[model samples]
Target: MKLSKNFTNPLAANNPVIVQILGICSALAVTVKLEPALVMGLSVTFVTAFSNLIMSLLRNGLPSRIRIIVQLVVIATLVIVVDQFLRAYMYDVSKQLSVYVGLIITNCIVMGRVEAFALGNKPWDSFVDGVANGIGYALILVIVAFFRELFGSGTLFGFDVLARFGYTNNALMLFPPMALIIIGCIIWVHRSINKDLQEK
Candidate 1:
């Protein structure tokens, strides 16, 4: 189904995090916990999906010379809507997310999707592309968050899921450096398994 492509394609092959590295900056910043990471992922998905949809509908009317400007406007407008919604509903998460939510306006993943696919494709196809890439970006962030949060905080979603064990929480995992290391380790494992992705 068309919707399947929109949701699944970004998980691999066209992954925004590993393949394109479009949104790694935020991935490193807010992924210190699974909760914030999940919030960021969901926010990006919403922004990308709607931006793609609207841009596709307007693509036909956009002037070639000012297409980039139009895309920026659409993406910024949707991001603000998303930001305001988050602030109203999840003030804590919004505070934790802070500048990153606003920074979503500059996230290469959203802008890239709008320009590369939405600007040139049908509305439906563009919507699918946005969802797909958002999934891809979220997938990596989730993995990174899972490891960082687990070892860093000794829990997921801040739940005492592993309280039974004598896990000594490594406070270092709570920092950005820990996230960088976790991501590097994941990329190493990924490259090892997919030999073709490694240097010959």
Candidate 2:
């Protein structure tokens, strides 16, 4: 049951993005298009899962004073790997993502999980928590990107989805503030459904 909660909680009830408001910067920067948002989400998921696993494995022996430094090293190394991989095979998307890929190292969601859950949990449990939180973040990115790309550019993954139907692209949707607006709407809907999250 605990493992189930570890894996399931972040999907909605305890999402890193909307609920905890952890990684909103990337959501705003990359959600301008679906492809980059998808790539960014996957990149974060990989880094989070492995960083948590590594940190959890090392937690017992890690000196408390240097733990934050060590966590940054681990996360940075993983982010570099993802960045290089994207540059190699997905150059266009990598270019679109720009420095935001490297910025994942500083992402609150990644380091927060390492400090909060991975340090205390078993390796397997920590890995589950990381994956869950990463996916939760990714899910929001995808939703926001979907609406942004559809209305902002009248395209999804560069395909003309609505242009033929007399849809005039809304330039405003492509901006970062639009992403925040979409996220706000999502939070409102989420809280309405999950009354437990609502303030008394």
Candidate 3:
């Protein structure tokens, strides 16, 4: 079904992170720890899904010349709401996330979906596409964060799993470069398995 493809494609076959590589900066920035990555993922999914729905609803009436401006306004409003909620309810995590949470407004994944899919599709379809792409981005962030947090901090979600086994954590895994390396490895493995992605 078309709806199913919109939801499933971004999970693997058409992953925005590994395939399109649209939002790699956030993937690298927030993956040093699992908690932040999880929060970031949820926030992005929420924003993208709602933003797409909003854009799709407005598509017919939106003036072509000011569509980008309107899109930013809608996105900014959602980002602010999410940011404020984080600051109020999850102060410590909000502190850890810092401006990155607010930066969701500018994430290409969000903007791209709004422009490309939402502007031309029905509300339900655009919503599905937004969620799919957000999950695609989030999936990679979580994967990178899992490795980085486990090896880098000797813990999973701060539980100290590696320390239990008497293994030392690798400091390199705490760095941003390591996130990039892990993402690169994921892309390599994905492309290897799905040879259709290989360049002709």
Candidate 4:
């Protein structure tokens, strides 16, 4: 049950993106297109999962005085690996992602999970929490990117999906602000559905 909660809560009730409002920058920056958004999401998921597992494994031996520094080092190393991997195989998407890939080291979602959950939890549990939160964040990115790319460019993953229907692409949907609006709508709807998230 404990492991289940760790894996499930972040998907909704404790979502890192919509609920906790963490990692919104990348959500907006990379969601202009579906491909980049998917790549970014998977990258974050990999980093989060491994970072949590590593930190959890080292928690007992890590000195409190240097915990934050150590966490940064671990997170940065993971981010670098992801960045390099993207540059190697997904060069175009990596170029699209730009510095946002490097910025994952400072992402509140990654650091927050490490500090909040990984520090004291067992390795497996922390890994699950990280994967859940990363997926939660990724899910929002995909949804936002789907709408943005589909309507803004009339394409999904660079394929013309709506052109045959005489659908004109909306230029405004390509902007970062549009992603914000979409995320806001998502949050509002999410809160409405999950009444527990609504303010009493």
Candidate 5:
């Protein structure tokens, strides 16, 4: 496959979250606010890209039977590094994200791409695939967070908008179920636009 396809496909047609329905845990967990969502998105993106690169480089030497175990070890190490970096530089956000950062090791998007794309592709292509899926995941996160923060608290990244317009915040938006509702809405719209994705 072309490198450009690796880079671009995941942003839409092959999006890890919207299309593939991978990585929904963090997408719903950290997206109650834009800041946390942004941080989580970037963190996942960083981890995915680097881990994909490392895995691609190691692919040839990896034994098929132990590959999954090795992938987990590498992913866990990367997640810890990212968590530590966040604690050092962005303590508050780190605290807010809490266990979610560590949970990246379990994220289906990361493992899925690492195994499905990186193991079989060149390192550069794997990196592009990683970045592409990460961006794809992040795009959904930001969109969900934007709406959640806006309607839930009457703010966008902590700036009041609905309040200024004499509107009351929708308290339901702050809850986890709202995130699913938003995601479902996004899926609905996506499937509507891409008729091929609709159920028969």
Candidate 6:
């Protein structure tokens, strides 16, 4: 797979969140705030990209029977490195992210992309696939976070963005359920605008 082909596909045609519906957990859990959501997104992107790169390099040596084990090892190593870097340089954000950071290990999107695309591709192509999926996932989270922070809290990134107009916040937006609704609405709107995306 070519890097450009791999990268663009994830962002649109094969979006992990919208198309594959993977990584919805983080999209709901850590996206109440913009900054945290952004951090989580970047972290996941970094892990997925590098892990896929490593897996692509090792694809030939790994046995089919133990492929899951190989994938787990690669994912775990990448997550740990990301965790340590966050703890060292951005303790506060790291603390906010908490268990969710560790939960990256189980995020189906990361593993799915690695197994589905990375395993057979070259390192560069795999890396692009990771980035594309990460971005695809991030798009939903960021959009949801933008609205959740906006309406649920009357702020953007925790700063008051519409206070002067006396727009009080709705507490419901901060919860995980609201994120689902926001995401659903996003999908509806996206599909409505792009009729080609409509269900058959």
lDDT of 3 at 123: 99
The whole-model C-alpha lDDT of candidate 6 against the native structure comes to 0.86
lDDT (CA) for every model shown?
0.85, 0.96, 0.93, 0.94, 0.92, 0.86
lDDT ranking from best to worst? Answer: 2, 4, 3, 5, 6, 1
Candidate 6: stretches off by over 4 Å: none
The TM-score values for the models, in the order shown, are: 0.92, 0.99, 0.98, 0.98, 0.97, 0.94
lDDT by residue (tens digit), candidate 1, 93-123: 9999999999998999998888888877888
Give the C-alpha miss distance for residue 108 in model 5, angstroms: 0.6
Candidate 3 ranges with C-alpha deviation above 4 Å? none
Q: Lowest-scoring 10 consecutive residues by lDDT in candidate 4?
A: 1-10
**Residue 174 CA error for candidate 6 (Å)?**
0.8
CA RMSD of all predictions = 1.8, 0.6, 0.7, 0.7, 1.1, 1.5
* Candidate with more favorable, higher TM-score: 4 or 5: 4
- Show pairs that collide, candidate 2: none
lDDT of 2 by residue, 1-200 (tens): 99998998999999999999999999999999999999999999999999999999999999999999999999999999999999999999999999999999989999999999999999999999999989999999999999999999999999999998999999999989999999999999999999999988
Stretches of candidate 1 exceeding 4 Å from the true structure? 1-7
Query: How high a TM-score does candidate 3 get?
Result: 0.98
**lDDT (Cα, 0-100) at 34 in candidate 5:** 98
lDDT of 3 by residue, 107-174 (tens): 99999999889999999999999999888888899999999999999998989898989999899999
Total clashes, candidate 6? 0
Please tell me which model should have the higher lDDT, number 1 or number 2: 2
Instruction: Please count the clashing residue pairs in each candidate, in the order shown.
Output: 1, 0, 0, 0, 0, 0
